[model samples]
Target: MDADTPRRHDASPGQVPHDLLATAELVAGGALRSRDRMWRAGVALGRPLAYALPTTGAGSPPMAGAATLLLCFPFDLEEMPAGCGYRKIELAVTFDDESLRALDLQPGAGWAGPDGARVTAFGLGRNRLRWTFEAPRTGGTLSPDGRWAQAVLASPAPLTDVSGRVQVRGVIEHPLLSGTRAEGEVRTRDEVPFSLTRADVWAAAPLAGRTPRPGAWALTGHESIGPPGERLPPGRQHLCLAVDIEKYSTRGNADMIRLQRSLLRVMRAACARAAVDWDACGRQAQGDGYLLVLPPETDDTRAVPHLLDGLAGALAAVNREPHGGTRSPLRTRMRAAFHHGIVHEGDSGYAGSAVVELFRMLDADPLRALLADDQSTDLVVAFSDRTYQDLVPQGYEGLSPVGFKRTDIRVKQFAGVAWIRSHGHAGPPPPDLTAPV
Candidate 1:
C-alpha cells in the first residue's frame, strides 16, 4: 500500500482464472533462485561479519553474494613433487547454533568449484569439520603466485544467530618453496618469492551445539579448537612447535621439492611412532617447515620430547636409505623449537603471542650458530624455558637430560632462556652446503 510499492492485482471475486492460485503456490515453493536464496539465507543467518574471495583479474573485485560468503584455500604447487597426482587439504567451518541447525548439510558432497578438487575426507565437530579435498588428477596444477585458486560453497542456508556476524578459517599447505632442484628438474632454480597478501583462504561457521559422533568427524579431538560460545575462538593454552629445514635454500628446485615431501613423510612416521597424531594436531605445512599446535587438553606433556626423539630416529633412517641422486646424497637437517602458552583460533588460522614466540625461537641467532658450528648434528631442537623446565627433567623414553644443554637466546622482540638438544648428523652435512640457516 506504500505509494511506490507494487501490489498484486486483485480482480473482482471470480474474475481470477481457475489455475492462478495453484500456479502462484508452485512458484512460491520452487522458484527460489540459488543466488537469491543464498543472499536471503545469509541475511537470516546473521549480520555480515567479514568475507573474502580470490581475485582473478585486477581493478575489479571478485564476485560477492548479497549476504555472500566466499572462501579460498591456496596451495603452492611449485613446491610439490612434479606430477604429484593426488593432493589433500583440511577445511574448517564455524557457525552459531541457530544458523547451524538451519543448515541442510550434505558434508562430503557439499563443496563445489574447480574440476580437479573433491572432498575425499571429512570430520564434524560441535562447531567445525575437518574437510579434506583431493585435487584433480595429474593435470591439476597448484600455483606459486599464492593466489593460485579458490572454492565456493554452492549452497547457502538461511542462518539464525543473534550476533549478526560470521567467521571463516583455513590453511594453504606448502605456502612457500625452497631452492633445491633435482637433476633434469624443470622448476625454478632460485628461491621462490613469497608475500602474505597473495595467500588464499576459506572459512566455515562453527557447529555450535551439534555433537558429531566419532566417525562423523575423523580423528576426533586430535587437537582442540575450543568450547563454543563465541564472539571469536576463545583463548586457550596450547603446545606450539615450529620446525624448519636447515640450509634448505641451497638445493635446486627439484631437490627442494623432493626433500620437503620426503621429510614430511618421515615426520608423519615419527609422529606416529611417538603417538603424536600429526593429523589431529593443528598442522600447517610451510614450504620448508611446519607449524603445529597441540591443545593442552588433548596433548600429553611428554608429547614434545617423544616427538623430538622420533624425529631424530626418522631422519637417521632416511639418511641410511639409498638416495637416487649422484651429487651428494640428499640429507635433511632440521631446527625445531617448542613452547606452550595461550593461543586463539582466528579467522585466518591459529594466532596469539605464544605462536609468535615459537617462530622467534626458531630464528634465534644462537640456535642457528649452534647448528652451523656442529656440522655433525642433523637435528637441533630448542625448548622454551617453561616447556624445558616442565618436561625435560622428567625422563620419558628416549628423551633424557644428558644431551640437552641450556642456552640464552634472543631474536627480535623475544629474549629468553631455553634448552638446546642436538641429534648427531646421520651423514656429513651435504658437502660444502652453504644454504641459509
Candidate 2:
C-alpha cells in the first residue's frame, strides 16, 4: 500500500483486543518513556538515514527503529472554537522486531477507538497502524509528517533488558519572514519532556574573494545575516583568508619580543595596503603575550586579498631577517592556522571576539605555549567586515559607515620582528632579505 493510505478499524465495544488496548493504554498513560539507551538507539538508526530523507517534508521517511500507529477522526474546527486545537493525534508504535510485537498483544479480538477517537489499520505485518482525528473547532498543532514513517520499526533489544517509552514531540512552523522553525521534545517515562531549542545552524552566501573552487578546503558553516526588507548593496561578496605565524617561547623573552615585532610589521603593512584605517582600530595585548585587534578597512572587495598578499610577504621577510636568528616557531604556527581558517576575522565588533577567545585559551594552556615556542612562526588571518566594534576608537567609531558590509582582515602571531625598522641601521638592509626570495 502507498505509505500515505489511511487504515480504519472498528473494535466491538468491550471486545477490544488486549494488545491494541495495551498500546493505547501506554500512550494514554504516557508510559512510553525516553531513555538514554532509547535515544542512542534512535540516533543509531536515524543518523545514517537522516541524509537520505528530506529533513522537512510530510512524505519523508521516519527515523529508523521507529513504528507509527496513527488513528484519524473527522471533527469540525468551527464547532470547538478553542485555541488552535488538534484535529488528529497520531499514535506511534516503535519497536525492533516481531518478538517485541508479542509484548503488545491483547487477549480480546478486534479493536475500537476511545469513545470519539478514529482508528485505521493498513499495514499487513503488524508493522503499520495509522489513525486520524477530526480536529476540534480550534486548529490542530502541526507536527513533522516524517514522524509518521519513523514510528514503524522493529523493537530494538535493550542493553540491560530495561524498557521504557519515549515520546519525541516535534513542532514545525513556517512563517513568511523567518522561514521555518522546528522545535523538538524528548520525554522519558518518568521525567518531563524537554525541548531541544538551541539554534546551532548558521549559513552564509559565498563572498567575493573566495570562489566555490572545486577541491578547495571544506566549507562547513553557513548562515543568513540580514533580515527581510533590510537593504543591502547588490553584488557578489566573498571573503577568504589564511594565517601563518611563528611559535612562542617562555624562556626567551628577548627572542619573543623580536618575533612579535616581525609579526606586527606584517600586520600593519597588510592593513595599510588593504586601505584599512588604523585610527579606528582597537588593540589588546593578550595575557599570553600576543596582541589582538580589529582595524578598520575600506568597504571594498579587494581589501582581503591585498591584506593576505602583504602578510605573506611580511612572513617571508621576517624569516630571512638576521634579527635574533632566522625565524621563530610562533610565527610558523600562526601562518599555518591562517592557511586553515583558524583565526576569526575582526571586522567591527563581536566578529573578532571568537578569535580573541581562542587566542586567550591557547595562552592559558601551558602545552600550547611550549609548542608555539618551538614551532615555526605561523600566521592567522580572518577576513571579514565585522570585528569587535567595542575595540574601535570612539572618535573614529562611526567612520565605518558601511556597517556590516565592510571587509576586515585579522593577523595573529606568537612572536616576530616589529613593523618599524630600527634607525641607525644600514641602508635598506639586504635586497634579498626584504624581497620575497
Candidate 3:
C-alpha cells in the first residue's frame, strides 16, 4: 500500500470471517459499528500477488484500508491480436447486493489505466466494472510471457469491506471475439484464456499469486460481461483445426454413438488442458467430423503442437477404457487437420479457403491412406504446409520435423500440401508423397 493511498485508522475490521464477501458487503454498504468499518493505519503490504487476497490483521488500527482482489488470467501478452489490440474486462464485485464502486486503478505492469484511449470505465453501472486496455496497433506486438492480465479491485475508504469471490470475463479483441465470447452465449464454464498454440504460454496454477491458502478470494465464475468499448474491424482470421473419425459411417450405430460421446469429451478435456476456452471457438459439429475456429489470440505454434499433444494423450486415455464390444484395445482412432487462416461465418454456414484447406488435409486420400495403414495409431494429424513450416521447424516442444512426413492433397478442386504425423510414430518414413517438388 502506497503512502499516497487513502487510509482511515480509527476503526478495525472484524476477525477474518469464513465468507469474506458477505462480511465485506455488510461493512461496505450495510450498517456497522465504528470499530468494524474503519481502516487500520501503519500497514504497508504494497501490492498483492496476482492470485491472492491479502487480509488485515489485529492491531491498534488495521492498515489494509481496502481489500484488493487480484485475478490472474491465462492470457499471454504476445497472443494479443494484431488488429488494434485491446482487452475487454468485465468483473462482478459487489457489496450490499450492489456494484462495488471503483477506488484506485491498479498500477500493475501490463495494464492500461483510466487515461487510455477512449476509455468508458467510470460511466458504466456499478453492477460491473468495465474497461478496455488499449494495446499496440498493427505491425507492433506486446511483451512476451506477461501472462497475468489482472483486475485489482480495491475497496473505498468510507466502507472498508472488500472480500469474497469475483466473477471475471475478459477477451482481447480480435474482431471474432465479440460474436464468439459474448457473455451468456453458452451457458457453461469459460476455458481459461490461452492459445494452446503458443510455446511460451504457461499453464495457470490452481490459484494465482505466491500466497495461496484456503478461504482466499477466488476468481472463478463469470456472469454477464459487457462488450468492448472500442470496436475493431471484423475479421475472419482464425487458427483452425479440423477433426474426423476414421471409417465413421461404417461403424455400427452403437459404436457411432460411443464415438460421438467420446469426441465431445475429448474436445472439452483438450481445451481445458490447453487453456483454450471452448467458448472462444466457433464450433461447427458434423456427425463424424468437427471444425473449430479457435480464438484469435491463439498462436499456431503453441496451440497446434499443444492441441495435437492433448488430442494424442486424451484419445489414448479414451481408448484404454473398456469400449467397443468387450474391452477392445481401441475404439476412437481419428484424423485431424491443423491450419491457420481466414474463416468466414455467415447466416447459413462458414466458407473460406482456411476452412477448405483444413478439410482437404483431413479428407485427402493420402492422409486417409496413412491412417488406414497404421491401424494401431489412435490419432493422426495433418498440418497445412504453411502451418508446418511455422511450427515444427521452430523446434517447439511436442513437435518435430523428423516425425512429420509431407503428404500431397488432391481432394476435389482443392489441391495443396500437408504434413502428416501419426500417433506412436517411430521416425520419419521414406518419402511417399505424390505432390510435386
Q: Write candidate 1's Cα lDDT for 385-406 as tens digits.
A: 8887777687655456887788
In terms of lDDT, the best-performing candidate is: 3
What's the distance in Å from true for residue 428, model 2?
14
lDDT of each: 0.46, 0.28, 0.48
The deviation in Å at residue 403 for candidate 1 is 2.8
Candidate 3: what lDDT?
0.48
Error of 2 at 124 (Å): 99
* Per-prediction TM-score: 0.46, 0.25, 0.44
Candidate 3, TM-score vs. the true structure? Answer: 0.44
Error of 3 at 380 (Å): 1.1
TM-score preference between candidates 1 and 2, better one: 1
Q: Write the per-residue lDDT of candidate 2 for residues 190-243, one digit (tens) a residue.
A: 211111111111111223354221111111212235666776432222122323
Worst 10 residues of 3 by lDDT: 17-26
RMSD of each: 22.9, 27.2, 22.4
Error of 2 at 192 (Å): 78
State residue 243's C-alpha deviation in candidate 2, in Å: 7.2
